[model samples]
Target: MERKNLVIVGGGSTYTLGIIMSLIEEKENFPLQNLTFYDTDADRQEKIAKATEILLSEHYPELESFSYTTDKAAAFADIDAAFVQIRTGGLAMRELDEQIPLQHGVVGQETCGAGGMAYGLRSIKDMIDLVNDIRYYSRDAWILNYTNPAAIVGLALKREFPDDLRILNICDMPIAIMKSYADLLEKDVWELVPEYFGLNHFGWFSKLLDKAGNDLTDEIKDKIINGDFLPTDKEIANDESWIQTFRQARQMLIDFPEFLPNTYLQYYLYPDDLAKKESPDNTRARQVINGREKRVHEHCDQIIQQGTAKDIDVEADIHGVYMIRAAASLLFNLKETFVVMVENQGVISNLPADALVEVPALLTNHGPKAFSVGEIPVFYKGLIENQHAYERLVVEAYYENSYNKLLQALTLNRTIVSAPKAKAILDDLIEANKDYWPALK
Candidate 1:
């Protein structure tokens, strides 16, 4: 196997360690010559880097080299690929994103509706910058982007680099759901191929085909409709908050039995339910800040204080292995099928040709070629059309810096439909995200 050099762009993120651990596990298949953690936050990355350094020395002594840096040139130079997982304003800003929306009686959550719209605007500039740097230093390096608000971010990237096939935008939510289905079927997820279509975070799986070409969609639908909402392999399913989120899928199934809805639909389809249940002060961000964020940092601190990675509580981010595997498939031309966001170009017959849609695609060294989604039901198409308009406007707002475009984007959102409500949420988000978001005219 050919070893490669890679960089983790947002290396300071708590998700970094897990990705590193996963790389170590995949050494035989996709070995790395060097792994660099690049982040602007020197102080934060340093803690995680120190822990990682000790982690390497203790276990994979033969692993040649690793380093951490804030230097852009050094970070991008001569890398085979880059894995980006940036959260622009950190969890502090996420607290505001969630809190601000809930204050106005809207769904206060990351990567959905009002909160996601705000976060998307902040992410565009950074992601564009990172991709530009990667292309400059390593023109052919594949960029596996796992950034949030993927619908907007994916659309923005397409606009900035229209022809750069190296950038692949993906979300792991569908992957996690597949894991649950795999567990239910007593088979691995890789053995199952899904027939799905729609915008990121808003899609429906109509079919699940196995390697032998048997259809498992009916079985899965029955299980879901009958209220057997299973546990997923990702971290989200393990949490109490997420468990409640998953349980709501039962109601969604009972309501729309034709297909299994993506978990995020709970926010869009049942807005009243979310608005009533969510806490303005004690939101998801607060839970994460007090739960995983605190624990991850505290564990890093322990590793730092002890000056050793031994007994460090960092778990392998199995959830992240999909990105690396996708990268490997591309670099080696292994031709793996995975769901990714891309310009539709007739992949979904009903949608505009240029819309950024998430569909299963064959990933190779040449980039992704999406499998055809002939067409969707009229009801689903109508819902997606509204979302596409919103996503497009967000990108326009970022590029044009038009205040009206931003307002229109928010108004199109199901969570903030009224022009007045849209303005209320937008103003609060603008005030909260002043430092990160672009100045709208």
Candidate 2:
């Protein structure tokens, strides 16, 4: 077993511990010669870095080495792989991203609608720089990016680093759904396989099978139509709001009983209902801030003060461990099938061949090659194409810094169809994101 060197780029993120804990637990599968945490914010990264130190020392002290640094050159040096899940503006910017749109009676989600667009605009630049740093220091290092607004960020990476095949953009939502499906069926997730298609956060599961290859789509669909929401995967279910989001899939299935819909689709399909359901004064950001954000930081403080994580309750992310799973696949050539975003090419006949889409792909040492989805039905085809346009234009808007393109992207969003409303929203977003987004004029 050849140990590898890996770095977590956004090591300060609240989500960092879950991944680090996962790596420690799965060291047998993906042994590491060196584990490094890299973040620009010195204060923010220190807490996570301290807690990670406790975790490593308490468990895998025999491991070669572990360190956290703010220097890109030092962190990226000699790394075989880099797991990138950067929240560019952190949670504070996320609050603005979600709050601004809801103020205007629209669905305000971190990774959907106007909120996702704002996040995309802010994220594109950092993603580009991160890729460049990784390539510069570790040219062949696999940049497994699970960055938000994945469709747009991934597309930008595809365009900006066209020849960098090692950059694989992936999302965990599909696998989370699969874990939920496995829970519903009372089986281990490994025993089931799902056939899914569409864009990130905007996809559907068309087929599912057991180890014996038993068809299970209709069974899951029947459960969903009857108001059976998937049991949240163990890792994410800890968040009550996330559990609620998981349950909303029931309504989605009732409306589109032909296939299982991503929980995020609720934002687009029922923007009015979603708006009414949310509390603008305290949105998901507030929920996270008051919940996971507060708890994790406090936990890290406790671990640091106590100088040991032996007593801290660290829940393993059963399904949210997309990075670890993908790394293992690449490291060992496991040929694991996962839902990842990739250049559409010929995967979806109707969508632009150059478009980046979220479809099932097999992860190998080289990267993911998306499975062909053929042509989709008219209803989904139209919605997907329109969303694809939004993603592409947002990437262009970031690159071109064109206000017109920014507004165009907002106008095409299913949650904000009117040009006037889109303009109004864009202006407000520009005001809120003035510090983060590019100057669009």
Q: How far is each candidate from the true structure, as Cα RMSD in Å? A: 1.6, 1.4
Residues 1-441, candidate 1: write the lDDT tens digits. 788888998888878777777776776767788889999999989988988887778766767789999999999999999998999998888888888888888888898888998899999999998898888899989998989989999999999999998889988888888888887787888899898898899998888999999999888777777657865765565688877877787788789988877889899999978988988878888898888777778888898789876776665554677888888888899888998888999999999987889999999889998999988989999999999999999999999988899899889899878899889999988888889888888
TM-score for each predicted model, relative to the true structure: 0.96, 0.97
Query: What's the lDDT for candidate 1?
Result: 0.86
Writing each residue's lDDT as its tens digit, candidate 2 over 329-421 gives 987888988888888888999888887788878899878867889988999999999999998899899989899998999899998888998
Summing lDDT over every window of 10 consecutive residues in candidate 1, give the lowest-scoring window.
310-319
The C-alpha stretches of model 2 lying farther than 4 A from their native spots are: none
The 10-residue segment with the lowest total lDDT in model 2: 227-236
Runs in model 1 deviating more than 4 A are 304-313
